[model samples]
Target: MERYVLTVTLNAAVDVAYTVPGFSPGGIHVAAAVRRVAGGKGNNVARVLARLGVRVAATGFAGGAAGRFIQDELRRAGVVPEYVEVAGESRTCYAFTDPETGVVTELRERGPELGPEDVARFKARYDRLLAGAELVTISGSVPPGVEPEIYRYLIERARSCQVRVVLDSSGQPLREALVARPYVVKPNRAELAGWAGRPLETEADVLEAARRMRTAGPEWVLVSLGADGALLVGPDGAGAWRAVPPQVAALNPVGSGDSAVAGLACGLVRGLGPEELLRQAVACGTANARTAGVADVDPAEVERLARRVRVEPV
Candidate 1:
């Protein structure tokens, strides 16, 4: 079997998006467009990875009609689905976009709860998948009945297999996984601030917070700054770089972060230098923002934007 990048989305969902022109509270408005697809942070990353010509597989829990939709969608997107079906139905998350105001309101549902058996089944499947995985990416929230320590266990297993892991999550799961020392941790500004227990107001503040996070366990801390671009702090703490992407008229910023994660994974697999890696990550993110669909980006656009990205040592 060929080694491929593995993406884990524990609480996978069917993402529904509605374009409502004059979206307001307590008002009747006809949606201009409605789109639904398989979505979770990891699934979004998988979609972008496939689009980038990477061999990728997605695993998580899925059930009922929504789960079927998710599996079919992944197949359509050129990603192999390796989900474990549960007794409960998978969730469907809704996002309402107001084109007039350029604002998006989201309503997300907590997916099905997992039992001990379900967890055991998933672990067994994950163990088998890890054998043929060059790298692993775990993203998004866990469903009810699953402990935060699950991420830690997964990271440990992947490490035991000598596979690098890129973790994109928040709260307790993020905190727990850090102890496993994943290769990379990608957190948005707000997520980093939450982990830091303080507000990061300036560039220096953000950099300092990222350094502190590095001490926890992760080899590299990539702090995503919406609009301003991203900051990458290396393992040694001495090497740091800031990537500023070329400005574009952003149509939707929903899954830009996941696209960035996909870019980082691709860079890692390709053995890119730090500067080039940051450029690719920022370019993918910026390109995703140009489209309304989540993680939908053109490779040509990404290449063009990568050339314009400015990366400098900090």
Candidate 2:
């Protein structure tokens, strides 16, 4: 049996991206280009992992025509889709990008609600997948009708199987999952600040907040700072490092964090050290930002960017 990474996106979506030259509110404009793919935080992570030659399987609730599209897209991308079908229709999220201003505006719909039956079916599938999974990534929001404690339950199950989990979420779900002590937790600067209930105004502030989160159970805390890069707090808060990328023009910043999570999972499975891990993670993020589509990174670009990433102990 091949070992693989398992990614869960409970509220999976068909992501649609449109490029408009001068996108402005309240005006009808023609799009220069359009792209659609399977998305949601975990799905993006799965896609990136597959691009990097990692065997990855994606699971969660998928329904309706949109859901079928997502499955087909993932299969075409070399990611195995094992989503549990639900009754409700999956959502379609839209992102409008203005190339002239380098701005992206997004509108996301709350996807199909999952009932107790749906959750039960998913858990059964998840448990079977965990058997072959080297790592698990749980990302994105909890859909309606599912309890926020869902993440906690999932983490506990993964832990029971002795599988390391990489969690990426915010708000109530994040708070609940932290108690389970995931192997890695990736939060953006704003998400960390929200959890800390205080403004993280400086590097020291961010570091302190990340350390505080470590006490909750995670072995590693990674806080992503757009442009400035990411901060990594090691196990037991023994060491902290900041990985900064060389500046590059960003075409789209959406899903960059998911790409970073993919990189982190890859590094962990490869047994990379702290510095190299951060370097690869930051490079994946930076490479994602340079692409017009979400989580679409060139392997050569990722390798090139990794060499330029400066990982400094903080």
lDDT of 2 by residue, 99-209 (tens): 999888999999987789999999899999999999999999999999999999999999999999999999999999999999999999999999999999999999999
lDDT of 1 by residue, 95-203 (tens): 9989888899999999898899999999999999999999999999989989999999999999999999999999999999999999999999999999999999999
**Which sections of candidate 2 miss by over 4 Å?**
none
Q: What is the lDDT of residue 314 in candidate 2?
A: 88
TM-score of each: 0.99, 0.99
Scanning candidate 2 in windows of ten residues, the lowest lDDT window is: 234-243
Residue 44 in model 2: lDDT:
98
lDDT of 1: 0.95
